[model samples]
Target: MSNIINREIKEIIAYGTSTNPKISLSEDQAFNVLLLQYYCFKESDISKVWYEILSMITDGKDDGGIDAIYFDEEDSKIIILQNKYSNAIQVQDVVNEINKIIATMNDFKEAHTGSYNKKTKRLLQESLDRLTDENEGNVEILFSSLATIDIHKIKSKLLGIEDRVAYITVLNKGNIEEMIEKLQLQHEVVAEDSLYIDNTKNVLKYASDQHKGIFVNVSSESISRLYNKYNQKGLFNLNIRRYIRNKNVDDGIKNTLDNNRDEFWFLNNGLTIACTDFVEDGNKIRLYNFSIVNGGQTTNLIGEYKGKNRDEFYIPCKIVSSVDEVSSQDTMKFFNTIAEATNSQKPIQPKDLKSNSPEMRSLQTLLLKHRVFLEIKRGEKTAKDINIKIKNDELAQLIFSFVNQKPGTSRSNKNSLFNNNKFYKQIFFKRYSSEVEKTEFLLDLIELNDRYNTLQKKFKAELSDQFNLEQANIFNNGKFVLFALFGLSYRIINEDVEISSLKSNSSLIEDDDFIYGPFISNYKEDDIEQKLKDLITFFVNILDEEYTNQYENKKVTSVSNFFKTDKKYINDILKTTVNKLGRTYLYKEFLEYGQIFKRK
Candidate 1:
């Protein structure tokens, strides 16, 4: 083993044996801490990373060898993690553990129903519901160990045992060392001898003291070598869109490479490479800090065409190098711009461009004035001035739930919602048109939502059984109560004496002037404290009525199903109640219930 690998192994061992109050010998706790540290090393946002880790902890012994699980809802992939923190583990033991996991997943429903913890059972069932034959290839089993083992030999033995799985990988000391090296590389701006290209057959397209552009007619074999050397670590790191494995595109590339090598350049937009510096000597061009900002498909295809018709093709490439004295931030910005520009031919998700957008940057700056950190880029945790940072993904979800008024859509399709056009065209684009207005609007909305979440938890603990409803309703549909509170605020501000005016202005609830200027300005903390309980009581009464109605009409067998089936009716009732009662009557009713469920 290399010294780096030995060092990492030692670190893991030391952490495992530490007597810190937070550390524990339990397998689940140890694995959670270990994986948390691993992802932390990968530079994931600490808050979001901890959220994912906590979500996966099953909290019991009968976890069926599954320490933690993550479902990449976007890719429709399930990542099953198993960690063994030991100095030495036999190959057979590892193989047996993997086989056991495969069997358990194969019979997921049965295994989960038997003796597993409630949390793991629910997670397993939800995961099984998401998996179908079409996405069976998305399952990834990762086995991690502190020991050094021959991965190739183990993979050979485990071949074909679960052919349906996407793939399996073993994370040992070598893999940990590679991860550490990648992390280190992320901090450096300059690289030495980063790329190798031939100079004999290629021509210099443009040359200057500060910039150089070269056009190369390179063989697929050489391109494959370049990809093997750098692509895995961070060659296309700046590209916003990740490479999706498309069989059709791969086949087309291979066909074109085999049939028409000369026409490949015309038919395809050749690769665009950026480098900090390079030097040409004899037949070789050595590049520094080189990254491919475009042509990910072509690079991946070249790697795939490794053994078949590999040498029969040559593709064109455009290599651009710069030696100008630029700051690291400017260089990163330049690369990000190139990445966004080059990927125009492919479909880009909203999140792909949102980080660098002018609106987001303006909002980020505005948020900083309030001591709130807004993270525009995913997995970025560089904001050091605040205790809580709101990630772009989380902000998007909040916008979807609050502004778009589709909390159900946000709940079911959390991953897909950010990429959808409606989120951009209907909500984000409209709200961000006026930066100051939208900034205040979002700040108020987040504050209100946070308080609502806290009150919902308290309600569940204190009154869930008394209300005679499932605890799930308190967790899932609590957003409806928040929406009702917004409507109530409008009623209070308008002082229309009749609730009918609220119906016309209900759409105006999302309006910034209506929410921040009118509603927030008029209400005090004590008013909110009283109104929150009233809102909860209002929702409870509506749910109780719906339960009785459903039970009498035989429309549902369980009271929980009432929330699922009659959500529209519940919303309509809440709206109509606010409309009929007006602000004065509602305040009177709140005072009546105020003395009963008085705030602690």
Candidate 2:
């Protein structure tokens, strides 16, 4: 193998060993993981865990020459992968593998009793059954070899088999190398110091105090080439809804480029670019540090297009930039404003607009030290060092649901949490005196939320009693409320805190050492989960008592309705429980509940 491929293989092995040391695999198995990770599942929303990927391997005896098989639920497709971990693979080997898969698919379709392993048959049968006409089930055959092979030759050999498969992708060493190169580019920002814009058409220029722009018709082929080179490298960083794939829209764009070239300029909305500056030469214009803030879908379609008449058409283009020599606070804000105003094809939420705000960027920087990634852009790449990818809206929801103690609003008014200036500032505008302390406090909330979700899933799957099942339903619906209650329980245990103290701005809440140090930080994951389960049991009983009281007075109808209404009544119940039972007695009750569940 070449040095680069060898290095990649070694890295994959190292990562697998590091991430999951209990399970081990050979180099061939590791290579399969690498290929599937980057090629089949990277773009699609599939599990990227090493152990999960390895679990899909059915490559033992009677495997039918297929290495790994996965059902991509996001795209509703079946992926059949065969990897060749070698530097010199024969063309016949590729053909034999494809033929084997074709036979296997036939077996699946006919329910034939084949010699394939039971695991492979079961997986393939189930996956094939999901691909009906209503959902447009697709089967993707990926034949990847470490050696350089003639893909066109292999494709030509499979000519009449298009009816059996949706599409076949054959990748050789060169293709893998190209994929690796693009993967590397996803980690870094790529800015073109100078790009030539076609100036053959009428170039309308406008100049303001600090803004400069041009309206022109740039060739689609040029845009396509630039997109091909810089698409993964921050080409659409400024785009609010970056490159959502709609098959119908994509086919329309490609069809027009292929057949209706003359009407392309009139049919589609032009691209809107934000740049640092631009200069016009004789027949070309040069743009620096530019990003496509609009027309992300059109640009992506054209970039990956295979139409022959791609170069025969031009797209309407509008490029805007600032004249400031140095990037200032005002200049960056200007760029953000332009990005917000130009995106109109897809509905832009208020949170989407705040992705580039100073507060968001500051929080992102603060969290990076703790290995938490704040994904602001729609499809931005997560850096290599990131341990977690929290979307901006997710953070907003978390803060509102847990810290602010408004679980109902967190669920129903999520957009308002970002849309209302006061709410947005309340959640994100805090300047942490100590970043590490603040991060740990927030991380604990995330941990609690995760444990709550896991227990909910267990209740859904394992519990059988009608009352418990009804409670589980309430648990699922009022998850955010339960999340807030968990935090409230912790605060109550630490001190005689009131309900209003759960607000994010409360000094008692901000004092992480005082609030989180003694109890939550002292438990292992198993212990935390047990404590959370017990807390939920105790809270459920309290909620029942409060609901019965209110129902007798004709104030509330049901338990779920009791949890769903305004949080004030819920807080009053919690306060009454803490005051009636006393913090010490309630703490003992939590422990007793834990012991009961443990015994069960």
TM-score for every candidate vs. truth? 0.59, 0.51
List, residue by residue over 421-521, the lDDT tens digit for candidate 2: 98888788766425555566666555555556677666533432323533543444456666666555555544546534443223343334333232345
RMSD list, candidates in order? 9.1, 13.7
Residue 376, candidate 1: Cα error in Å is 13
Worst 10 residues of 1 by lDDT: 557-566
Q: Write the per-residue lDDT of candidate 1 for residues 259-348, one digit (tens) a residue.
A: 776677677777776777666655556667767778888888776452344444556677776658677777777666666777666545
Per-residue error for 475 in candidate 2, Å, reads: 18
